[model samples]
Structure formats: structure tokens, C-alpha cells
Target chain A: MTVGLTHFLILGTILFSLGLYTVFAKRSAIAILMGIELMLNAVNVNLIAFNRYVAPESHIGQIFSVFVIVVAAAEVAVGLALVISIYRDRISTNVDDLDWLKW
Target chain B: MNFSLLSSEMLAAGLGTGLLILGLIAPKTENRRGFGYITAFGLLAVLVATFFQYGINQSTFHELWIVDDYSVFMKQVFIVAAILVVLSAVDFVETLPRFRGEFFALIVYALLGMMVMASANDLITIYVGLELMTITFFVLVAYQLGDGRSSEAGIKYLILGSVSSAVLLYGMSILYGLTGTTTIPEMLTKLTWSPILVVAIVMLIGGFGFKISLVPFHMWSPDIYEGAPTPITAFLAVASKAAGFAVMVRVFLLGLPLEGAVDWMLLISLLAGITMVIGNVVAIPQTNIKRMLAYSSVAQAGYMIAGLMSMDAPGVKGILFYSMIYVVANVGAFTVATLVRRALDTDTIADYAGLGQRQPLLASTLTICLLSLAGIPPLSGFVGKFYIFQAVMDKGILWPAFVGFVMSMISVYYYLNVALYMWRDDPKDDRPVPVPGPAKLVIVLSLVVTVVLGVYPGPLGELATMAAKSLF
Candidate 1:
């Protein structure tokens, strides 16, 4: 059986689901960051596959995917810096520890 | 490149970059008040420039950026919000342990994001503009690194915000796959009702729901509001949420096929109803003022969404007018809170005792702001609510409007409760609460606008109507 757009979409969906699960289940902030990265990668895959199969003439999808990669990188950098700052203050990277502002 | 068409955005970007560079070269001990003043004045100038471009309709760069009455009206609101934030923030920024000049510059960058988001005609531009704004907010929220709550709020906002953006992106990808274009109008032409399209739209709405803090997606707001600096909280509450609505109007009203296969309006009305109920009900129990306002802001968004669900010219006009009033009223309220927080180092409603006697001006200003937010007559919020309800009533969507009206009445209890604390309760410590000059100016200006607009809303109303007309 030859792989096609449907197969690529299936793989992308699975990766996205796993990433979302990791984000919700993981305690460590770094692990959650990894989850977010995974989700973004899934989106990138979807973008490229669509660009190749659906709209091969226009580079809009390709350009959008590139922009997504750049934005994701910036988001992770800011996320890590914030995590490190919180870690320095509380000495823990667990999500539970950052509950100072809870109702 | 038609430089004249893009002058306002260019001015904002140039000034923001200039401030960033100046912030680096300035000495550590230099007073940062000048930076705030420059930012406020520069933004005001840019706002004036935008007024000249208001009637000149143009779309450039592959139709990604459009200059029209709607964008111009929204840009004016954002510029005004930015000016108020910077002016009020001068005293607060001065009190930080380390005053970085980039604080002022970051605000300009965020304002630039909002301005771009207002005019974004393409999906790619919207995504980019939104990320630019949110990323700047991440830094601004954590600017006070010595404060633990600030850093915690920053991290929480970052994680949640990125997840939502990724979801929004996934939705955009699906849309692109189906339509094969990122341009909103082109995609609108090609859109057909498919299960996948519904999924994409739902995901997009869900993503925007997080930004505007409608009910289920609002878990992070109270924490972030209670933790982030007061001015930044005010920014997030007012300008950022307005941008979200701008995108919503652009995407849902203009881009999506509202009258076609899918009934997105009903879904939106459901969200609006739930949001109004939850936001008002939850606000009643909050003792912390920022947290309380966070819930109130949520409820406010619900009211605007109710107007948006009308999906007509009147509905869009109501949204525009309501957003303007909300910026003035809410910003004024937060300015008072900021002042009290500075004086007392607390944000509890109980601690606001005897504030009326101690600081008559601030107490009165806060009262006006809160009453306006509660939709009391003779204030801007009342007129705003009137417009919104009238629009919804026109569209024959009475349930949500009834919910909104009842919620506004319920909201009056908590809003006036703050006034009760200020006026009824006796002073614990009777030292007068001093109001700084700039902050006092911000409060007075916003209060005047609030009342002035309430009494004679014809000018802004006409502008809002004009702005609404541009969408179709």
C-alpha cells in the first residue's frame, strides 16, 4: 500500500494527540514544553503535506509553516526563560509548585 | 511601497525600536518617567496620524494588510489604551526594583501587534500579529522577576497561550488544506460545509475563546490577573481582549459563511450565554479586587459576544461602541486599583475601607468606573450596553440579551460592594492616600470621557457605525 495524503494526515493527528496528552499529563514544565513542540511539529507536517498535495502551485502553506517554526522557537525560548525564573524562585519545576496565585 | 498608507504602523514600530535602543544606552539610575512620557506622547502622535488615514481605503502586500474605517477605529482605541497604560504605569514602573527602559518599548511593540491584528486581512498576518502581542506580554508579565507571583503568572500564561495558538494554527492548516489559500476573502469564497470545516472553525473559536477568557477557557485569568502587575492586567483585560473581538468579527462575520451550511451563530450565542452566567456568578464570591475584575472582564466579553452574535451592522456597531466605553471605564477602574495597591500594598476589597474619606477623588473615580462597568445609566457603559441590547433585540435574540441584562444587574451588587467598602467601612489607618500627578490625570481624563460619551454618544456612535459599514 502506497502512502498518500490520508496517511500523512493520520500520522499528524496521532502526533498531535500524543503531544496534547503529554501536555496534560506531564508534571514537569520542560516535559510540557516538549509536548507543545510536538504539537507544533504535527502542524508543520500537516502544512507541508497540504502544500505538496493540495496547493502545490502556491507556496503559501510552505511560507506559513516556516513562520510557524520561527514563532514556536520564540515561544519556547520565552517559556523556558519563564520556567527557569519560576524554578529559581521556588526551587522546583513541577506545575503544582507554581500555585501562589490560586483562588 | 506606499509609505503613506503604512505611516501609522511605521511610526509605532520606529518609536518602539528607538525606545528599545535608548533604554539600552541610558544609565541604570536614569529616571524612567521620561520614557513613559515619550511613549505616551509618541503614541498620541501616531494616533493622530492614523486619523488622517481613516478614510483612505487600501489593502497592500498581497492583501495581507488593509487600511479601512474598521481598522482605523480600532487603532484609535488601541492607541488611546496604550497612552493611558503608559501614563498610569509611570509611577508603578518607577517603583520596580530594576527599571528597564524596555518596559515602555515592549508596550509599544504590543500596541503594534494589536494595530496589525486590527488590520490583518490574511490568516497568516493574524497569526503573526497575535504571537507578536502574546510573546511581548510574556516578557511584560514577568518584568518584575523579583516577585514570585509575576514569574508564576508569566509561565502559566506562556504555556496556555502557546497551546491555544498551536491549536489555532492546526485549525488554520486544515482551513488552508481545504481552501488552498491563506487569504481570508478567497477562503471565504471556497468554503463549503464539511465535517472537517466545522472542526476547524470550532478549534479556531476555541482558540479565540482562550484569548478573550470566555468561561471554560478562563481558568488562567484570575491567577494571571492576581499575579501580574496591575497595569499589565489592565492591558490584558482591555486592549488584548478587544483585539480578539476584532479578529472574531473579521473571521466569523466576514470570512466564514454565516448564512450558509453551518450555523455558527447559534454556537456563538450558546457560548455568550454561558459566559455571561459563569462570569457574573463567579465574580460575586471574589474578595481579591484584581480577581474580581478578571471575572467582571470575562462577563464584559460575554456581553460583547452577545452583540457579535447578532451578526448584523447594528451588532458590529454595538461591539465597537461597547469596546470603546469598556476601554475607558475598565482602564479607569484599574488605575484606581493600581493607586490603592501602591498606597496600601494590598488588593483586598475589605482593605478598601475608608478610602472614600481618605482619598475622595480616587474613591469617586473608582465609583464612577465601577458603576459604568455595571451598566448604570448616565455612564458610557450604560450606553454601550444599551447599544448591545438594542442590537441583540433587533436581531430577535432575546435570551442572551436577557441574560446579559440580568447579569448586569447581578454584577451591580459586587461592583457597588466595592463602593460600600470605600464609603461605609471605617478607616483602619487614617493617613491620606496620595495620588500622583500623572495617574490622577489618567483617572480624570478617562472619567470625563466616560461621562461625556455617555451623555452625548453621537460622534463615537457615528464613527462606530461607519466602521461597521466597512466590513460588508
Candidate 2:
């Protein structure tokens, strides 16, 4: 049996679902950032699988995955910076505690 | 690489870098107000350059970057927004404890991101441009590091905004997997009605929805608006939102097969209906003016989405016209808020009492701006809404348009309530509110544009029509 696109696609779907769950369910800000990273990696898997199995001739999929990696890196850097500063200010990194502005 | 076509972008990039370098060279004791002047003048030069390039359409770099009327018009809008924000933020920046030069530099960088976004013709460029804009915004939102409210707002925006971008990237990946291309026009060829495509489209909408603050995705905006500095809030409300709509229009109209899926229309219409209803309804109960404007901005985005439901050139034109009108009116309103926030050190609606008696010009300007936002006649918003509803009417889709019309009426009450508070009630302290010269110029400029375009909308209306037609 040979590995195929469907198998990779299914794997991507599961990873994406887990990421989505973590983002919505996590209370810690750091945990939320990890969830976002998880989601971006799922996208990378999808891109690589498509590039290998579907369009071997064009490198658009592979190229896009690299872009995603760079973006995710920048996002995490900023996210962690924000969380640390908020921690410094409030002594906690919990999402619930960040709610100073409410209706 | 046809360098001439990218002259405006290059100019912006150069200015941003120059400002950063200048900040390093300038003495630490120097008044940073000079940085603000440099940025404003640089933006004004870019605006004039963009205006001069009107009607010369071209595409370069394998058609991945476009230079058309639509992008040019959108570029002009972003430049105007940046100029207004920089001007209004001059005094406000002086009040901040640190990072004054970096603040102005980041603003110019963000403007460049918007310019690129407006011109992006491929998914990769769009993603990059959007991240460039959002990352700068995350910093801008959290610029007051010592302020807990600012840091919290920044974190909220960072988390939510990143999640939305991840979702959008997932959707884009799927679209790429299916189509083997990222260029929007080329992708249109491979698009078909498949379950995967359906999921992709849904994800795309969800991602863009968060950016435009359409109802469910709008949770962060009010908090961020209330927490971030008022100028940044105004920029987020006007330039950022406009950039989102511009990219949305490009992607949805050009990339997706709107004609293939009537379900997409239903989906967007539902979002629009709920967004307008909730945004306006929630705004009524808010006492904080910044948060109130946040909800009101959400509702305004809903009206623009309503225009998109028509899915025709006129509908797109309606969005274009309405977005321009919105930038002027909403920025005017926010500038007034900034001035009021500075004077009273409060944002409560009740505290605005006796404004009409004390600072008659600011109060009256804000009233006119709010009235314009409420879609009152002889104001630009009235004509803007009329165009959108007319386009929706042409589609024979009466319900969403009807919902929009009624919601506009509900919106009028709350908008006028602010006016009533200003004119009717007495102030606790009857001290005078000082209006600085630069901020006063911004207010008067926006006021003039609002009233002028409201009365004679032909030239701008024609330009919007052309821009909308170019996309199709």
C-alpha cells in the first residue's frame, strides 16, 4: 500500500480540529498561542501533501508553506511578547483575567 | 519588474525606513513632533502621487500585483486615513511615555501594508500584506505597555486575529490544493461545487468575518477600541476595516464562483442581517463612547456586506462609496472623541453634557458626523445607503435590504441620543475644551468632505462605479 493524499488530508483535518478545540477551550494565553501554531502546522501538512501528490510541476504549494511558517513565527513572537507584558502588568496570563473592558 | 508601476509602494517603503533611521539619528531630547510632521508630509506626497496615477491600469510580476483603478482608489483612501491619524495623533503621541518615533514609523509601515493589500492579486501576497498590517496593529494596540488595559487589548487582538489568520490560511491551502494555483483569476477556473470547496469557502468567510467584525467575530473590537489609544482605534475602525473589505471584494468576486453557490449568498446575507441587528442593538446600551462607536462600526460593516449580497457591479460600487463616506464620517467622529477624551479624561456619554454650550464647534461637528453615520438625508451616508439598498433591490432580495433599512432607523435613535446628551444636559465642570490646530484641521477636512460629497456625489460616485467595474 502506498501513502496517498487522502491519508494526509485526513491527518490535516484531525490536527486542524484539535487546534480549533484548543483555541476555543484553552484559558491560558500561552496555550492559545500554541493552538494557533498547531493550526498553522496543519496548513503546512496540507500544502506539502498537495504539492507532492497533485501538482508536482508547480511549486506554489511548497512556496506557500514556507510563507506560513514565517508568518507563524512572527505571530508567536508577538503573541508571547504581549502575554509576557500582560503578565508583568497583571501577574497572570489567564484570558479571563484580561477582561478589564466589558460591556 | 516594471519598477515604475510600483513607484508608490516603493516611495512608502522608503519613507517608512527613512523615518526609522531618522529616529535613531535624532537626539533623544528632540521633540518628536517633527517625526509626526515628516510622516504627515510623506503621506501627503504619496497621496498626490497616487491621485496622479489614476486611470493608468497595469499588472506586473506575473499578474500577481495589480495597479488598477480599484487599487489606486483604495490606496488613496488608506493614505488619507494615515494622514488624518498621524495629524490627530501628534499631541496624543507627545503624551505617551516612550516609543514616539517608533509609533509614527509603525504607522507608515502599516500604511504600506494596506497599499500592498489593496494591490495584491494573489493569495500569497494578500496573506503577507495582511500579516504585515495585523502585526503592526498588535504593537500599535499594545503600545502603552505600562497600561494594563492596553496590554490586555493587545493580547486579545493578537490571539483572536492570529486564530482568524490561521483559519484563513487553512482555507487558502485547501483552495490551492484543489486548484493548484494561488492567483485568484486562475483559481476561478478550477473552482467547482465540492464538499471541500464548500468547507474552504466557509473558512474563508469566517476568517474575513473576524477582520471586518461581522457580529460573532466582533468580540475583540469593543475591548480593543476602549483600551487602545483613540487614534489607533480610529485607524483600526477606518483604514483596517476598509482594507479588509477591499481584499474581501477582490477574493470573493474574482476567485470564488459566486454564481455557482446561491448558498454563499444566503450565508453572507444571514451574517449581514445578524451583524446589523446585534451591532446596532448592543450599541444602544453602551455608555462608553469608544465602545459605542465600536458597535456602531460593526453595524456599518454589516450595511457594506448587504451591498455585497447584490453581487453585482452596482453593489460593489455601493460598498466603495459607502466605505469612503464611512472613513470620513467615522474618523471625524473619532477625532472628536480623541479631543473630548483629552479634555475631560473620560469617555462616558453623560460626561459629554453641555458640550454644545461649551465647545460648540466640536459638539456640532460630532453631531453632524453621527447624523451622517445614522444615514440621515443630505449627508453622505444617506446616499451611500440608498445606493446599497437600490442594488439589493435590483437583485429582488428584499429581506436583508429591509433588515438593513430598519436597523438604520434603530441606529438613528442612539446616535441622536449622544447629540441630546451634549446639548440638553449640564456639565459637572464648565471648563472650556481646547481644540488643537492640527486636530482641528482634520475635523474640518473630514467635515468638508462629508458635506461636500453628500451634496454633490457625482464625481466620487462615478469613480466608485469605475473602480467596482474594474474588478469584474
The superposed Cα distance between candidate 1 and the true structure at residue A26, in angstroms, equals 0.5
Q: Backbone clashes in each candidate structure, one number apiece?
A: 0, 0
lDDT of 1 by residue, B1-472 (tens): 5567678999999999999888889888788889998999899899889889867888999889898899899888888999999999998998887745888999999999999899999999999999999999999888887899999999999989989998999999999999899888888788888889888988898899898997889898999998999999999899999999998889888788865556788778888999999999999999999999999999999999888877788889999999999999889999999999988999999999999999989999999999999999999899999998998898777787778889999999999999999999898997667789889999999889999998999999999999988888
Residue B220 displacement in candidate 2 (angstroms): 1.5
Best by TM-score: 1
* Interface DockQ per candidate: 0.87, 0.86
Taking all chains together, each candidate's TM-score versus the true structure is 0.99, 0.98
Candidate 2 structure quality by residue, lDDT tens digits, B131-223: 999999999999986989998889989988999999999999999998888999998877877888888988999999988998888988999
Candidate 2 per-residue lDDT, tens place, A1-103, comes to 9889999999999999999899999999999899889999999999999999989998988899999999889989989999999999989998989768886
RMSD of 2: 1.2
lDDT of 2 at B55: 78
